[model samples]
Target: MKITVILCYAMFLGACLSFLGGCASGKSSASRVEVTPFSCVLAPDTNGSVCVDVVFRVPSQYLSRRSRLIIVPQLLLDGKLSEELTPLVVDAPIYAKKMYRRKVVQNYQDPYDAYTGKVEGVSGGLELPYRETLTIPLGVHTGCVQAIVTEDGCGGCTGLDTVEVASVRNLASLIQDTFELVRMEPTFHEGKVEVLLQFLINRHEIRSDLGNNRSQLKKLAGSLRPILADTLTRVGDFRIYGMASADGSRAFNTTLARKRAESLREWLLKELDIHPELYTRMVVDSRPEGWLPVYQAMVDDGHPDSLFVGQILRRYPGSDDDVQEQYIRRLSCWKDICSRYLQKDRKIECAYTYTSYESVLATDGMWIPFPIKQMEANNQAILCLRRGQFEKAVDLLKDFVHYTPATMNTLAVGHFRKGDVKSAEKLLRKVKLPEAFRNLGVLMALQGKWYEAYRFLKGSGSLNEAVVALILSYNEEAEAIMAELSDQSPLAEYVRALVTSRLGDDVAFEVHLKNACQLDELRLRAAGEPDFEKYREDKIFREIVK
Candidate 1:
């Protein structure tokens, strides 16, 4: 195949990959290739890491003639400057049209680019990104560019040109990691009380002047006013968490969460003398409704806590108004103590307002500010759920998000535990799952769209669920994944074992299972993970145990 490099005399249309030193290969037919989102990546960015992917298309005709596709990728930042490392290659390409990648690096620089200038070594299937180490800056820089390509074509070929490439944008914000724990520095002095509040629960600073407890509120405010003033003046950083419980309607919880957050904000500004200047960075920790689930999460996750969920649950059981109010107040106080030391981020915004549940729930109740009857249930349910009363909350509310392959397919075990496949399919329709639903390959598989899934998952440049779906699956599609597993072959074998088992192919299953056991040591960290349900039943699986 002749990839005619239609360059106007080596102008280099944004750094290109030239074929090998060949005499034009007998001037063959036009070889076509395509690339998407043109960036090459190194490793997995599942945690705090970063990733890059480049999409390029190559002729299917020359594919069988070679065993692999050789791709040389480069990194560029701030327009013209290249990364510390210039070019590298990945052996076998997985997708002819697109490539996916993950990266691991710590950077303070801005505007990153992943580019490929050449492609070589061809076989069947997609391609892989070159693996190498490179530094990425974390500053915000716009309009920067980089390229990755298959540069090993006929070097002496007059038609030497870039068939595909990728790019990257270095943004100036840190990823607010979801799994990150509450960052707190403890201080202890004789007779001084230090409180702890997890971001998951009691995220907002609420300001509700209960008519029944107005006197108590005022008195408490007065006593803390001086300390509040000092705390506000010394304020350097803040973390406002938006919280809601699973006890009410999704509509109600959403609104209630926002309002409670404001209530806390108001109290801080008024009695605490906190400056209004720090408003923008004060984000409410947005979470599911109800303090109980949050409290439970903290307890299970081993976060700092003043009281256990069981103790707090005993305080309020949905019927006692006084019990509910007391719990709310104690939680508020604890949050204040924690906030007194919370380091605020200058870039995040804090200016916001929320409508309280009491206010919104009161339709004609003059005592309530935002009046509407149904709104009360959401706020009340959250309280109940926090008190370890899920049954009561469910009676008053409906489940909002669904766990499933389409919803959070990245999380197979969680969804499996929440419900069976039948229920998952139904729930997935409504959940806003990222990437999970945006993939055609995975979707096609659900509808028995095998070939289509292959087209999308195998060739698409971006990291769609379809391409990596094999990592969690074992079907014909999964078999394709093994050939390209590279240094990550053990992972592929384990997945193959699972798929073969699902298909009732015992022979294939055992073979891959053994292969997976050998590699289990490499991934021993995932040993007890519930996600490995498929392997838990096999005897050989026990052999992999450390």
Candidate 2:
């Protein structure tokens, strides 16, 4: 009995020793965590977030069958963790941002877009070779880390790494941040052409016509053709305006101006058949030419309607104010010469003839082509897209997109024009577009795409664009525009009210239109508006619109 009892006790002691040894020699530390293709975050925004885009590179050192990702993003200020955080998911380029510049993001490139981040599942496993994007809004000073593989009970990802964080933010660094890959802004601006023609100017002086100009022009136009085509595929109304330098005598300057306009026009006709630069800031009408009080006021302010008109008549550049008669006489003499040539249908080179806006419109304007050759090379990419050539279109479009990020309508237009309307619509639905889309709404309406017009218009700016689009897109004319008008702001409210009343919900429109006429600005725009033709003829409409 004693021997049996001793044997039992020895067996129990052996079992306890085995259990203690197992606990002492644990393998948790040796439990390796390998995250490959991982991107390290050097800086995070004020929102306390940084995106992690590491791929789960299979460990060659050890089989990763039992391993998980161990992310160690640092804390910003207060004690915080990225465990509960979620970043914005997208497919575009990333931009790093601070709190101050978001207000003027359009003018400034989207700093967030310049940034690139990756998105992965939350403590969940994803199939290999997956692509994802995560937008991590910054808090004061924290970075974010997400695991693609599940680690329900693992403590490897619990704390931050002990390392100093370095950050840079100056103009140069900011520029680098904005265009890390490349800049597409020039894909639309003429800056590309200017850059290619860098040899045309001797530092700042325009050289006496260079011979390399032809070679440069050909390369530039050809290189930019696909670019321009893509740009135009994304825009509307190639408005073009030409300006002359402040130099030369009235006649010489006038002739030079005409030549410049003609030259530009010829270039457009030769290259871009439909693409054109938009013209801006044309001097239009003002209150009637003469009122004694207003006239005197103008004269006192160094401007008189007659004098202003006369200066224009004399073909005088506004740069000089002294010796009006001397300039006028020279203009008169030059004008007579130009008139004779005009009467005989004769031609005179630039640097000889004096001209006016009216005169130019009658002659040189006729020869000015619609799309300059320089412009055509940049536009006309829709040919392939409209023919259902998506891969070709996407290739060209992507290159274009890499250059100009704001031209979202390029994809939309290309897809729509290509008979892939569903794809076009779907593509636009993916991102929150800028208010620039307002212009696209009007453009669509101009193209007779009423459905797209309505869609784009309805999705434009909050107050102003919405009101304008409502009136413009409404079935009727002035009714809808009139309805939104208020007496407080005649120009804004009344125009809207008129449109609303004439075209949209009449009851709501007429009530507002009448209120608009009670204000001054509405009365002013109505007097000049051609859209009010029918309104002006109807006493009721006229009374309300006016």
Candidate 3:
């Protein structure tokens, strides 16, 4: 009986050792947890989240029947824990049964019970695959994903292990945080001038001494002098209309008017020494003065018969000159009208149209050709600012007499570009110009105050505004603003590339990025840009950056 009992105890001890050995083998860390794609990307999602994809695998027979495996995925930024993801609990048969009885029979609740997945029959014989996409708020530059696994008995914890499943590196280089500059637009203007001269009743030749003709001619010459002298001015439309009195026959007056107009044109060509090409642009025409001037002169003189003459003139509306002159001849005031107002009708009228150009300072500090009448100090300063000559712009604007809102805004931009933030802010605060708002937005964006910048930049239709939208992750808004930009500059193309990149239009991103890299500065920038990091291996992207 004693030998039999001893043998039974040894057999029971062997069984206990076997069960413990099975649990011990499950605790071995070698190949217990397998994470595919050890190197991962923590990329920005269109929904404004930083996300990573991971697949967690457990080898067959990795779990013991009496134990459970608790897997907790975590995100670490710069070696510190940043975010904890949902825990995935894999329950072996015995532990799963205990958990079920605890919930159903004992009315017990475990906080992590909701995340548990049951493995039927023997737990160590089945493999477990947990695939997840972990997401966190944007702003983490570098990080890694790790899984914390705990193997526990039905009643208590047994073994704990932590493994780095994936890693994120070199992410800080992806950010594009530069602010864009806004340029001042050029101004345009058109002007018209007129000159009038009187002539003798039967003469077509110009008389310098007739009816203040010398002073009038001098004034006309003065107006044309600047336009003719200035290379920027373009003479557009010019007209010379010669007038004749109603007293003359229509045929004779027509001839006299033509001669008068021709005489004036020839005199101008001679006096101004206008080029032959310019002379060809002048238009000389003639028309009979009819009785309107006589009527007007009568009214001005307060003649008693003026009303009667006006009635006679109006009575022959649209009639031939002969019919109108015949009606006026019978009037009692006809003699006086011909002697006084008839002279007034014999005159030359001139109208001139001209266009002047204004010089524009391009972004590269080069002057774009047009014509500038004269560069005002403030305007010059504005050009300097656009050209990135910040100090010169500030100096030019320092003693300026006019403190208009536009000038103030321009001065602020200069100050801002020169790193004088306080002065820029102070100057901007004093003005209510739309340009000031845009500059203020740039300031806000530079300081990382994205929401404030967006408020000021909204609808400003500027590249700076578009960049702020991009920084704020408003991809659609940024793309819309970028698309509306009329500027086809390299900087504009660069911004378009960024917007399209975030919007997931790889085709457009490649096209724009290629165009933008025409400039060496943007090319260098794209090489290190985090936004384009995903495309770093692409043939076209590599070629562009290279």
Identify the leading candidate in terms of TM-score. Answer: 3
Candidate 3 ranges beyond 4 A from true positions:
1-202, 205-347, 352-376, 380-402, 488-490, 517-546
Indicate whether candidate 2 or candidate 3 has the larger lDDT.
Answer: 3
Model 3 root-mean-square deviation: 15.3
Candidate 2 local lDDT, residue 81: 42
Question: For candidate 1, lDDT tens digit of each residue in 112-182?
Answer: 23433324455443444433334454432222224433333322322223432433322111111111011
What's the true lDDT of residue 261 in model 3?
Answer: 85
Write down the lDDT that model 1 would get.
Answer: 0.40
Candidate 2 residue-wise lDDT, 1-546, digit = tens = 999999999999977874443221222333333344443433322222333444443223221122222223232232234333222222111111221254466465533343323323222333233233333343122233433222211222221222222121110110000000111121233222221122221122212254454564566466445534553333322322223222224444344434443443355455655343421221111111111232244456563233643545356443342333344335434453233311211111111111111111111123222223212222444455446665565545544312222234455555555566566555455424453254455444433344565566563322333333443344343334333534255444554554554454556556656666676545544443433444557667766544
- Give the poorly placed runs of model 2, Cα more than 4 Å off: 1-378, 382-395, 398-403, 429-436, 439-546
**For model 2, what is the C-alpha lDDT against the true structure?**
0.36
**Candidate 1 has what TM-score?**
0.20
Each prediction's whole-model lDDT (CA): 0.40, 0.36, 0.71
